[model samples]
Target: MTYVAVALLLGLVILVHELGHFLAAKAVGLPVVRFSLGLGPVLWSRTWGGTRCCLSAVPFGGYVLLALAGEKDYLAAPLWRRIAFSLAGPVANLLFALCCYAAVYAVSPGEHSLAGYCVKPLAWTLGTAQAMLAAIPRLFGHAQELSSLVGIVAEGGRFVGASASRLLMLGGYISVSLAVFNLLPLPPLDGGKIVCDILVRCRAGLARYYVPVSACGWLALIALMLYATIQDVCRYLA
Candidate 1:
């Protein structure tokens, strides 16, 4: 039951992201006709102040539809407001992460010592020398262990220093990760849009070359992922 509650609470963080979009769009006098939590078909809905807010059938993602936001006229509004609307979702995620961290630190408070290996700042270092003294080989480069699942197994059962703090750190890691991923200067993504904006304002000719280069870079990344996945599967089967 508590696990379910944790999931539901996490859902609120995502909802807050959509709310940020709704609020920013409304602030700029944009027509926000549909606000939906999750994707696909609507589960339930309400119309308020000319906005049709609904809960959708899918649960993993959500959106606030600033009416005509994707169309040409959406650009009729002020440029600053448009940028603010584009930025709101990720800003909301950072705020939600702070709240999550607060909840975690409230439970199982720990010290910055070796005993913290069972407590926390599990590998805290007072200075450079201490950090060097405590350095240990990691499976994934300074990564820390976090949650425990009831029916899951880990490589070599190596959860020697797992704790709530580590788990919360992982949550923050994922949130920041998304922000970083979204900010990458690639096309078909927020970062790409920003890059396009800059390139248009700066060099008109080089922007022509950016698109093909972006496509090739994406293809390379996909190939790398496929190679890594195949290696992982082979290793697991072995």
Candidate 2:
């Protein structure tokens, strides 16, 4: 049950982001050849007005493939329109996070609003969400807990309950975080695109290497961090 909730939450936010892209592309006369939810092969799809929108097999994330969005077609379009399309995805994510925060806040105890770091998720969220779901098994007379305490992480603790003001604050913080994460100046990612754009206009020699170098560098750092974490885990377990 806990896993299901987590997946659904992630899927919904991602889908809304894709929808934002789709809508913006259509509005700007940029054909969206394929708008897909999830990562792999199609589970289900429907074509409308020269667009093929699909739900894919992967549950991780979704994409809106704006037709020729990276090519001359997009470049030929009005600059404002192109910028709007680029911004739509993250805007949708913020809105989705807000809606989720509002619903959760309304159902809980104190004051709540969509102004803060709701989606950032601290370490306690998993366990809290898990424990809450485990209690539901009682309706079926099951004695075992459905989800167990995982670990403590930032943005997950003390997030549950009745405060609307705090909930909204969390939501806003997470939305800003998502925006900033995408804005990061790096390749195969949104931030990378911006850097590439700059390199193109400035005739920089590093244009081709911008994405690859940053990506590889980050990957190496992340791998080292993971290795260190595994060593720590093994030590603790031993």
Candidate 3:
């Protein structure tokens, strides 16, 4: 039951992040091709408001595809719209974290005031974001401390088993982590996408290389995930 709950919670976070991008694209008048909750082969799909919503076989990650097919197509959109589409996913995760933190405060046994409910959660969310930013540099120094989704789910299961409050806290932490991770200035990440878009817009000559750069980014990201998973498995075994 604990593992099941953790899985569901993780899925919800991914869903929320993708939903943010989908909504932002729609708001900016960009045609969305698909909104998928997972990756790889589609298990089930249905068209809604001209967008194909899909559930894929893999449960670890998700994406929102715009109607654009190539670099020219993507660049045709307004720069601000592209930036908004990129930013929305991380912003959604942050807001979800805030809600989770608020829930944690609400459920705790205490003489909570209106200000307490409002201020404490905001403070905690900001604090968590700050801590994550601070820890980013340390992660490079302490690569072994890095964790994959496997480790995250395992740790989350433990928290869920401890108590409801701890579960909420865990959820909030994971949401913030998701937001921060996506904001890293590496290729294929939201931050990376934004940076590339801005650079290309400023220097149209760079447009030709976008696809190759993005492909390389995806390769690097996959390699990192595999390495992290191996570390998680070895840790569990030890």
The candidate maximizing lDDT is 3
Total backbone collisions for each predicted model: 1, 33, 0
Best by TM-score: 3
Residue range 199-227, candidate 3, lDDT tens digits:
99999999898889999999998998999
For model 2, what is the alpha-carbon lDDT of residue 84?
Answer: 72
- Cand. 1 TM to true fold: 0.57
lDDT of each: 0.55, 0.57, 0.91
lDDT of 1 by residue, 177-229 (tens): 34444555666345665565556546656655655766776686556445555
Off by over 4 Å in 1: 1-10, 110-170, 197-238
Candidate 2 lDDT over 1-238, as tens digits, reads 3333333444555677778878988887777789888888999999988888888897656788877744545445565666677777767665655565545555666755544335423322433344434544483464222121121111223552345555444444444444444544554445556555555546746545654666785696456445555654554467
lDDT of 1 at 210: 57
